[model samples]
Target chain A: MQQNDYTYAVARIRFKETKLLSDADLDALLSAKDTDAVMRLLHDKGWGDGTSHTSDELFSMEEEKLWSFVSECIDDLSVLDFLRVPNDYHNLKVAIKCITRDIEPNGLFLSDSVSDAEAVYEAIKNRDYNALPEYLRDAAKEAMTTLLQTSDGQLCDIIVDKACMEHVYRLGKESENDIIRLYCELFVASADIKIAVRCAKTKKKIGFIRRAMASCDSLDIDKLSSAAAEGYDAILSYLASTDYRSAIDAINTSMSAFEKWCDDDMTAVLKPQKWEPFGIGPIVAYIIARQNEIKAVRMILAGKVSDISENTIKERLRSMYV
Target chain B: MSEILNNSGLFLALLGAAFATFMAGIGSAIGVGKAGVAAAGVLSEQPDLFGKVLIFQLLPATQGIYGLLVGFLILSNVGLLGGVEEVSLLKGSLYFAASLPIAFAGFYSAIHQSKCSVAGIGTVVKKPDQMGKALILPAMVETYAILALLISILAVNGINGIQV
Candidate 1:
């Protein structure tokens, strides 16, 4: 498709981009006295309204606003299915677990998912696999069955997570847009690396490790699984020879640090798209930036409310796209 | 046929006028349409930028007017806009040639200029303070279009003085 097709959409995205949080803004939030203080700061910056609200409420509001804005800008949002597909899988996991546990799935399911979380929950609740979207239908059945049979929540998560990663990877490969493909590549690959690191730490065998990790182009699943079997260091050594070599130090520090590096590096890599006037790239970048901004603010609020150290909070903050 | 060739001068001159009007008009339409979409996007969010984006959207429009102006010049020179007069084959050919610079330059320049205008609109969206700079970039595209207009005008007027 012609890149200019998104000219109008991208132009609106450009204006929307100005509302995203910058590094300096994040720093200011870092200095805020407490969670309420941070929310006040965000309110002042046009994050939420001036009305009294909790951070979670404000975060949900902002996510809704983002989806509304993006929906207004583009005609077809299916191009973003790769981004939302993970939410579908997460909701599926929540539903299966909640149903099996005979508990309410309140406040746990994500908003703005492809399929309605409540609908997904109901479908799973009634054991009507046909009601779910085709992409989630098979995975939902398998995960629910696995949880019922094995009574292993982790195994259920494994089944659902694996399906999620494979679906994201397949979508990325099928996409014609470079930004979508690249985002999916890093997303699945990073998940694989994290799984490898976790498996290596937990001393899980190669079979379970392979079962957990999805195949992506950037990471060699076989080599990574084999290296993961050895230990965390071996996994690190294996990554050092791959594209993720630069993240070795962050991995050495901690998985949380590695997660931060992944987010920060992706923003840094996609930052140039902010200046682009036309294409799906800028729109995707804006979405990523907004989501990251929300994540950073949530972390700050969580840390502040719990009285976590400032330096520790700063360590976890993802880089701003601005 | 010899009959058509003998009367081809008037036909050719008319064709030249049509070229200037339609070719550049098409380009301007495309340029203005593209810029207008971007401008609308900005206005939907920040309606205060209407004046600033309006200027950017109108920048590509000048080429269409220039095209119309050249078309009029060609029509008047060949007497189509006034009294019917016989124009030699050579003079008709010269008029056709003169229309080319604007016809093509206006066509391509409007498109390229609109690209610059679209980028400028994006810049203005982020930094409304840089409106002056943003306007200047696309206006530079006008220089070439003006140059083409200059040549076409001078050439058409000069062709009027020829005895052929």
Candidate 2:
């Protein structure tokens, strides 16, 4: 469809954006004395469906509400394949692990995947790889076979994770929309960087790092893999020459800090969509923003429950879109 | 050949009238439809903003009215509505030339104005108080259509004074 076709959806997104939690709202949540106080503030802000609920219940309900609202706004939800592909791959991973271990995969699947997790589990259990989507069929069969032969779960995970990243990058590249393209690029690059960092810290071999890291436009996978084989400083030095030079600090800080940087960088990239009045950019940004909000809320609730320091939780909180 | 030339003037003049009305009307329809879609989207979320969005939706509609006014003046001046049974070839050609400004300008201006209106609707959806500022951006696009209307009306009225 033409960009103008999203005129209605963009306008609605603009109005909905006003209701998104702002930085001030995050601060207010941060200042709350406990999770109960945070929940009270959330209830006042109309976060949940208005029924008395626990933090997890409220978070889950809010996530469901976001998807439902998106479904209402758009006719073809396939435009959101970039966002949904991860969940589908996650479900595939869960299904393969559960079926191999002979364990029931209850409550291990995400509800918002493009494919039903339970169906995927069933298909994997029956060894009917054809039942999976074409993009996932080969990956599922390969991962299951590798797990059955070698009994190595990490290898299976790496195979599926690489496939998922490759699929997301392909989908983004095929999309005519700039936002989706940027999102896919960032998603793959970030994942690749995360893998490089983890592998570097674990002193993994070059072959394993190369196999695990997905190719993306921004980062050089070969260089990143070699850096991972070298050491953490080499990875930092290599990142210094790329567009992600600023992220080196976050990497040096802690894994959580680096993860926070990824989320913040995405928010920074998508912040301009607020003023954009046309196309799917605003809608995509809105969905990402809501997800970020939910993530921040979950972190806060977890922190409050565990009695973590306010300053620590505050550092980890993501910046809101509104 | 002479007969064809004589009739060609009237044909051209009538074609000009049709172009003025049809092209501009299509542009306005498109413009209004685009803005209406955005307005409906906003109303679905916040129905209270209907009054503001309605004005935005109507902004591109004026180009159609301008085109119609110019078309009506040409038809009357050429005696298509009544009075004179025929026009000289020179006067007919002049009328056709007179219709060109609104015919082309109104056709493009209204379509571009609708784009502005749609963006304005987005602004109003987010910041209701910014309606005044938002309305001004789309209203700026109307200036060209008004200029075209002015030139077409003056040229049509002036054509009647020629001795040809």
Q: Pick the candidate with the highest DockQ.
A: 2
Task: Tell me the docking grade of candidate 2.
Answer: high
Interface RMSD of 2: 0.7
Determine the backbone clash count of candidate 2: 0
Candidate 1, residue A175: the lDDT equals 89
Instruction: Provide DockQ values for all models, in the order shown.
Output: 0.82, 0.85
Question: Which pairs, if any, clash in model 2?
Answer: none
The alpha-carbon RMSD over the true interface for every model, in angstroms, is 0.5, 0.7
- Model 1 compared with the native: what TM-score? 0.96
Model 1, span A1-322: residue lDDT tens: 2544688988898898888888899999999987777878898889876688878889999999889888888888888888888999999999999899999988999877888999889999999999989999998998899888989888889889999999999999998888889899999999999999999999999999999999988899999999999998899899989999999999999999999999988898799998888888898899999999999999998999889998999989998999
lDDT of 1 at A157: 90
* Chain B only: TM-score of model 2: 0.95
Give per-residue CA lDDT, model 1, range B1-164, as digits (tens): 87777578888888888999888999999999999999999999899999999999999999988989998999999889779889877788888998999999999999889989999999999999999999999999999999999999999899988889
lDDT of 2 by residue, B15-127 (tens): 87888898889889988998999999999999999999999999999989998998899888778898854677887888888888998889899889988999999888878
